[model samples]
Target chain A: MATMTIAKAITSGLRAVLADDPKTLIMGEDIGKLGGVYRVTEGLQAEFGADRVVDTPLAESGILGTAIGLSFRGYRPICEIQFDGFVFPAFNQITTQLAKIRSRSSGMLSAPVVIRIPYGGGIGSIEHHSESPEALFAHTAGLRIITPSNPHDAYWMTQQAVACQDPVIIFEPKRRYWLKGEVDTESAGRDAFSAQVVREGTDVTIVAYGPLVPVALAAAEAAQEDGNSVEVIDLRSISPIDFDTVTASVEKTGRLIVTHEAPTFGGIGGEIAARVAERAFLSMEAPVLRVGGFHMPYPLAKVEEQYLPDIDRLLEALDRSLAY
Target chain B: MGAEHLPASEFDIEELEQSLVTSDPADAPPLVQLMAPDGSLREDTKYGHYAAHLDGEALRAMYRDMALVRRFDQEATALQRQGQLLLWPPLLGQEAAQIGSGTALQAQDYVFPTYREHGVALTRGLELSKVLRLFRGVSNGGWDPRESNFHLYTLVLAAQSLHAVGYAMGVQRDGDDAVTVAYFGDGASSEGDVHESMVFAASNQSPVVFFCQNNHWAISVPTEVQSRIPLSNRASGYGFPGVRVDGNDVVAVHAVTRWALERARSGKGPVLIEAFTYRMSAHTTADDPTKYRELAEEEKWRERDPLLRLERYLRSTNTAGQDFFDQIAAEADKLAASTRADVLAMEAPDFEDHFANVYAEPHPLIREELEWHRQYQAGFAEETAGQAEGEAR
Candidate 1:
């Protein structure tokens, strides 16, 4: 085991995947000598040479389109979109081409491509940089969306995403990049799709993912003051959400509160709330609640605190669940 | 140029801007022609020898390929009219552009084609009946691309251009001499992905050939809307050679495509070949060219039909006799008849295949959904059986 930040863990994970398979390559803008905007790929080009770790021209569509071609040629290319909002330029390629090619080919071809985007907001960044657009991709089928909240998952899930034959979008919580944790490089404790239970409780279940896992844990800890035991489940995968795990937890806790940094309407939390309600209806103690951003755009950095769902919001939701 | 932003005293910005805005096809690169539209062979110093090795048998085979695919296209259109196919994209006049470039490719070369390359699919040894499965509504894709080195047809215009460049980059990395050919049309050339494809191919020096069949129309809109200049000239802006060929001339297209493929495979970077042709039919079964084009314009292009030109050249050179033409016609009819049978006999795949292969790895949700679907289907079967027993009672 080694102690490192989520950013370093992802870097290490990329390095390990490159070393594991010679066919694997890394491509993005400013990812070579300048190391990436966040320095996640620092020193990689020097190690892997310019061919494997390419610093591509500043076009998101070109990066993804060529990566799809590379995948067709048997190259496992891991593409990095510099930020969350910038992914829209490549959205057509991702949702239409990359996601549909597998079914379109009728099992003849599979693109083992991994797209990594540092998503979610909490660092007081600018407008486009600080947006969690995971819900947009989650709605598309044939895509696997995974986000790792800690260094351990960041390391293992990054490798898992590269190994996956289906095109995967790794929504790395940009806000948790500096959060340090121990990662056992030798063994992956779980698969990339399963929702993990970080805290054990019997009163109410709090479901979160990506940047919100830490917030949920903090909320669970604060709930002890009210003598309300809360269980926190980190939803690792967004597309094929592990409803079984969440449903199991909901069956036990009987009350569920799903939260995220994305908008509450038409968000991942809404899907989770609906599914848990359907699957565990008889065991319910209260209607499933959701706490997330508002319907409007990610607001100006000054008022983002009020816009983001904080621990107070989770506690309030928890209070509503207990009241019910 | 950076000099455009300079002061007037330093640079003639107004003159340069005027020259840049002015686009005349006559000013574009000279068109490559080895065969005149009247079926006369012309001698060219550069590309004439590329077709010099083709003996009488090879010329006859090329004629047979074009004739057969044209017949197959007609049959498919007939099937669509009969309601056997959902839709069919006819490659009526662009046969030479497809077969000539497609046959020029070596077995190792890969092809990325737009949806109307049935002739190219033939050159790749893909079963023509399989192509009908897509139109028959039985499959989205009907063949294994790995078997033919020909990717499934891309319908979203010009999207496959970048994929072709990237595959060529992979070939470069693998130290292979095979060139990847991307087939699009004049209308698709206007897409940004095509521009980026050229930039990436040029930047990486990837072995790729951009084969654009200027079929004159993108559905209702004419090629003029896509480019004010000849589509071939766009390659010059990206630092590569671009050649405009008489798309109706098979010999010229084959020769030019061969030259471009050789140049790319030899690491001379990418080349763009614009095959100037016309769409003799609607864009697809859904389109009506009469709404946007004139019968006089269609008649003018009919005089330069690719199949007729090839046949004239064959007869003038005594490369094929009347017996050979009759034999090829009989063979084409037989093949078309068999294809109709095969398409009619094609079956809808089992439901299991539908849920399968969406992901290579087993997905829990897919597994659960498949199971639920099985149970749902079983409920219907049980309901019918129970009703049958009630009738017996």
Candidate 2:
């Protein structure tokens, strides 16, 4: 076990994959010398050489398009989209090409490309840098979308994403990059697609993922003081959501609140809420609630704290579920 | 007409810019032609040597490929008209551009073709009948790309350009000599993906050939709307050589494509070859060319028909006798019959197959949905059985 930040763990994981497979390559804008804008890939170019770690032309479509091609040649390419909002330039390539190639070709072709994006707002940055677009990707069928809340999962998930045959999008929580935790390098406790109960309780169930996992845990701790035993579940993968874990937890708690950094309307939370209502309706003591951003766009950084879902918003939802 | 609104001067900046954009077919760039439209072999200093090695048998084979693909194309169009297929994109006038470049590729070379490259598909050794599976609505993709080193046809224009470059980059990484060919039309040239594809290919020095079959029209839009200058001229801006060839001349397209492929394979960087041809038929079965184009223009293009010119060359050169032509005609008829038979016999795959190929990994939702579908299908079978039993009683 080693203590490291989520960013460091991802970097370490990438290095290990590069060393293990000569066919693995890392490509992105400013990723080589600059070590990525957030320094997630710092010192990687030096260790792996420029061929393995490439600084591509500043075009997202090119990065993804070429990544698709490289996969055809039997090389696994990991692309880094600088920010969540900036990924739009490559949206056509992703939603149309990468996501459909396998099914379009009827399993004849597989693109094992990993697209890493630093998502969600908390750094008080400018526009385009602080947006959570996980729902948009999760809506696409062929892609496997995963997010790591801590160093342990980040380490293993990064490696697992490369190994998977399907193209994967890893929505790295920019706000949690520096959060330190012990990562067991030897073992990955669970598969990349499954959800895990980070904290166990019984009164209310808080289902969160990516940037909101820590917020859910904090809300659970506060609810404990209020004599509420809240269970917090961290959803690792967003697309093929591990509903079994969420349903099992809801069966025990009889109350559920789904939260995320994206807006509530047409968000991942709504999908989870709808599914849980169907699966665990008999055990439900209260209506399933969603706590997330507003329907509007991610606002200016000065007032983003109000737009983002934090511990207070989660607690308010918990209170409503308990009162019902 | 008002004096001020009358016109700009001939040498005015606006007039000069307008002159750069030509709708006139006569104002095309210099072309490399090994076989002239009059059925005679023309001499070219730079590219002539590439075609010099073509023996009588090689020439005859090229003619055979062009004729067979044209026949297959006619059959597919007929199938669409007969309601046997949903849609078909005719490669009527652009046969030489597809066959010439396609036949030039080595077995190891990869091809990324646009949706209308039926001739290219034929040259790549694809089961010509499988191409109809897409039009027949039986499958999204008809054949395995790995078996032929030919990618599935890209419907979204210019999207495959990037894939071709990326594949070439992979070849470079693997230290292999194989080059990749990406085929697109003049309309696809306007896409941003093409710009990025060229930039990456240039920067990486990837071994890729961007073969743009300039079929004059991208549906209703002309080549003039896509670019002010010749499409090949755009390559010079991207730090690579571009060549314009007589697309109707099979020998020229073959020679030019061979030269470009060799240049790319030798690590000389990417090259762009613009095969200036014409779309002799409607874009697809769904399109109406009479609504958008003039008959006189079609007549002018008919004079330079690729098949006719090749036949003229073969007869004039005494490379093929009347017997060879008669045999080829008979073969085309047989091929057309088989293609029609094959398309009519195609069966739709199992419904569960749709859910199965969505993801390479074991996705829970796909699994659950597939399981539900199985149960739902079984329930219907049980109901039918019960109904039959009740009727017997």
Candidate 3:
């Protein structure tokens, strides 16, 4: 076991996959030589050579489109969108082509590609750099979206995303990139898609993913001082959400609150609330509430605290659910 | 070029094999014209070298292929009108463009085509009936693209250019030296995907041929509106060679496409061939060309019909006789009739197929949706049972 930051874990995961498969290639703007904006891919270009760790031109559509083409040639291409906001330039290719090729060809073709993007808010600086756009990709039909909250998952899930036969998008939690945790590098890795209940409780259940996982755990610990029990479930898989574990938790807790860094309006929380309500209707003690950012573009760093969801908001949401 | 850009492929997926069926060649560019509308041979030294493979028998076969595909297109259109198909995109006047370019490809090559590549599908040996399953509403796409190396028709404009480029890049990596063709129309040049696909293709030196059939109309929009200049000229801007060919002339199209494909397969980077052709038919069965275009314009194009010039040349040279023409006509009719029967008899797939392949692996959401559908379908039996009990009461 080794203590490492989430960024280092992700870099290790990328390194593992590159070593495992010669067909695997990494391409994105500044991913090579510069080692990515976050330096998550640092030292990779030198280790793997420029051919495997490629620095692509600045076209997001071209990155994805050519990646899809490379996938056609039996090359497992991992495409990195330099930032979350920049993914929009390639949105048409992602939605229309990347998401449909497998079904469009009637099972004759498979686009084995992975798209990696540093997503979510906190480090706030630029116009479009910090945003949680997972909902947009989750809504797309032919994609699997995953977000890892800590170093261990960042390590394992990155490898799993590369190993998946279907197209996958790994939305790395940008805020949690520097956070350190113990990573068991020897383990084969857990099922990357399942939701893990990080804490046990009976009064209420707070579900979150990616950057929000640690926040939810803190909320649970804070609630303990108030003599109220709270459960925290980390959603590893974003698109095909692990509702099996979530529903079981809701059945036991009888109350739920979904949280994320994305705006609550049409966010992934809505999908979770609706599904939990449908599947665990009889077990519900109250309407499943949500804690998320305000309905606006990610704010600048100065006031980002007011816009982001923190422990106070999670506690407020928890109190409302328990009061019912 | 910007840092984000690579030198793009020529023409935005807009190569069509040549001969524009226009009586007014006065406005047409000096393309690699091998056959004049007056039933005489007119060739250039460079292009003539490329088409040397077109002996009398080969020329006759090209004529037959064009004729048969045209007939198949007509039958499919008729089926759409008869409510057997959802819609049909007819490749009426652009037959020479599709047939010539498609025939120029080897079976090992991959093709990414726009929806109107019925003739290309024919060249790749896809059963015409199977191609109609998409139009017939029974399947998402009718044929296995890998089996024939012909990808499913891309309805969206210029989207396939990137796929073709990436596939070509793959072929380059594998050292297979196989060609990949991306087919689109003049209007598709405006798409951002096309821009990026070209850049990626050129940057990687991928073996792709951008075959843009400038059929002069994108739905109701004219080709002139899409570009102020000829589409082929756009290739030079991307730092690749582009050529204009008479799309109405099969020989010119075959020769140009052969040269382009050869250059690509030889690792000489990409080529863009603009077959400046005309779309004689409406965009699809749903369109009314008379609403936007002039019948007089149609009449003018009809005077320089692709089949007419070829037939005239064949007759003048005695390359084929009445017996051969009669035999081909009969064969075309036989194939169309059988295809009609097959389309008519095609069954709607078992409902299970819908949920089965949503993912290569089993998915919970799909399985749940499938169960819901099954229950919905089974509700009728429960209602029938309830009705019987009520009647007995």
Candidate 4:
């Protein structure tokens, strides 16, 4: 086990997949020579050569559309959309084509493609850079949407996503790229679609994903001080969410507070809340409260923190649930 | 008199037809056509190389493919009205255009289609029930492309053209003789991807056939809005051969598509075939053509219907008898009934089925979510049990 930043873990994960499969190729704008804008793909071009580590044109749609073509031709392509906002150009390819290709073909063609996007606000980024479009991909059928909260899961999940037969949308929290954690490369389990309970408690269950996992952990830690034991679950897979861990935690805690940086309306949080309400009605101490951004679009950088759900807001929601 | 009317100088129909058959640059006016609209063959046509490829059986099969597709299309439209389907894109008048090109391909070839290519999909062996799922709102895609070598129906206009070009590039990489055909409408010709596809196909010398069905109207938007010149001429600018075929003429479509596919297979790059077809029905079950266009224009096109033209040709040649026509009609009716039954009987996909294919490996979050749903559903069962006990008390 070694301590590494999320970027390093992702680099290592990509390296592992490349080493494992000769057919695996990574393509994106600046991903080959510059090692990606965030350098997550650093050293891959040199190690894999130009053919495998391709530097595509500046078109997001072109990148994804070509990736689909490549996938159809028996190559597993891991495409990186430079940033969250930039993914929209490729949205048609990803949602209309990549997502539906497998089911559309009635399982004849499997688009074992991974679309990696650096998402969420809080790095003080401009417009289009900070938006969360997970809900859009999740809403579409035949696409698996997942995000890693830390370096360890990032390392394991990225490899698992590459190996998966279906197209996987892997959203890495851009702001959390620098955050470091001990990644047990040897013991990093290869579970691709399940949720994990990071910190266990009994009073309330706090569900978060991607960038908001650390915030939820912090909120849980703070809630512990006030004699409230909060169980925090990291939703690694956003779509087809691992509801078992969530429901078990909710059943034990009897209260739930879901959090995310994306808007509350039609968010993955709403799906979790609705599911929990139906499943754990008797066990719930209070209605599932969601700690998320406003229904409006992601705000300006100055007020992004206010718009995003943080430890304070999450803890407050926990307090309200405890009061009930 | 209206925006629809253009001066005589804008388009010379005779000159365009003459240009279609021959490669003589001096005599070839920008477009290519080998057959006249009145079912007359043109002299000085460049399609001699492909004339031997079409036989009696092949021609009849192409006609049968079109007729069967038209019947299924009418059934689908009726189904939409009956509320069995959410919507249906009627390819009513464009049968000859699709079947001509669709039947021209080898079994190993790939086709990237826009949503309304029901004729093409049928030729590729896609079951009618599978196509129904997409319109029934039960599934996004009705069939797999790999099995039949046909790509899924792309709904986002001309995006499939780029996909086809990319696939053709892959075909070139594999050193394969298989070609790819991209089917789209004139409205799709306006999209950036279509232009990009042409450029890429030309630059790469990729084996692709860009078959554009100029069905006149793209929803409420007419062909005039999509292009200033004919759609076929746009390919010349991209450094490839472009031809405008009488889309209603099955013979023209077959000859042109066969030539294009053969050219692609032999590494001559891409060829654009603009089939001058007309949309005989509304764009979809939801669209009202009367609201946007004049009814008189539709009636005029109705007289030159592709099916009728083919039937006339078949009868004049003494090729199709009453028994053969009746047999095809019966087959079409049987197919429609079975398709409707199969579609209506399709069970709603299992909720857990959603989690199965998201990833090849089990995702931790999805596992938890499935468990959560199970527990949640169990709670409902517990409530039902409690309700039963309460009634007993």
Chain B TM-score in each of the candidates? 0.93, 0.92, 0.91, 0.88
Tens-place lDDT per residue, model 4, B1-393, is: 001223686478886766655453323233344445554555435764565566667767777888888888888888889988899999999998888788888998999989998888888887757878878876667666677887777888988887887777677757788899989998888887787677667766789899999999989999989877778877877778898887887777878889899888988889999899899999999999889999899988988787777666666677777887888899889888888788788666777766665544455555776898999999999999999999999
| Tens digits of lDDT, candidate 2, B1-393 | 001122457348875776665355334568989988999888899998888888889889989999999999999999999999999999999999988999899999999998998899989999899889999999988899999998998898888999999999999988899999999999999999999999999888889999999999999999999998899988887888999999999999999999999999898889999999999999999999999899999999999999999899889989888999999999999999999999989987888889988999889999899899999999999999999999999
Off by over 4 Å in 2: B1-28
lDDT of each residue in B1-393, candidate 1, tens digit only = 000122564457776666655565447677888989888989899999889887888878889999999999999999999999999999999999998998899999999999999999999999888999989989988899889999998888888998998898889889888999999999899998899899888878789999999999999999888887888988988878999999999999999999999999888889999999999999999999889999999999999999999898889888888999999999999989999999889888887887887788888878988999999999999999999999999
Error of 3 at A54 (Å): 2.2
In candidate 4, position A319 carries an lDDT of 77
How do the residues B94-144 of candidate 3 rate in per-residue lDDT, one tens digit apiece?
988999999999989999988999888989998878889989989878888
- lDDT of candidate 2 over A36-63, digit per residue (tens): 9999889999998888899888999999
Candidate no. 1 TM-score? 0.96
User: TM-score for the first chain of model 3?
Assistant: 0.98
Clashing pairs in 1: none
TM-score, A chain, model 1: 0.99
Q: Which candidate's DockQ is highest? A: 3
Q: Select the stronger candidate by DockQ from 1 and 3.
A: 3
* Candidate 4 Cα lDDT to native: 0.83
The whole-model lDDT of each prediction reads 0.91, 0.92, 0.87, 0.83
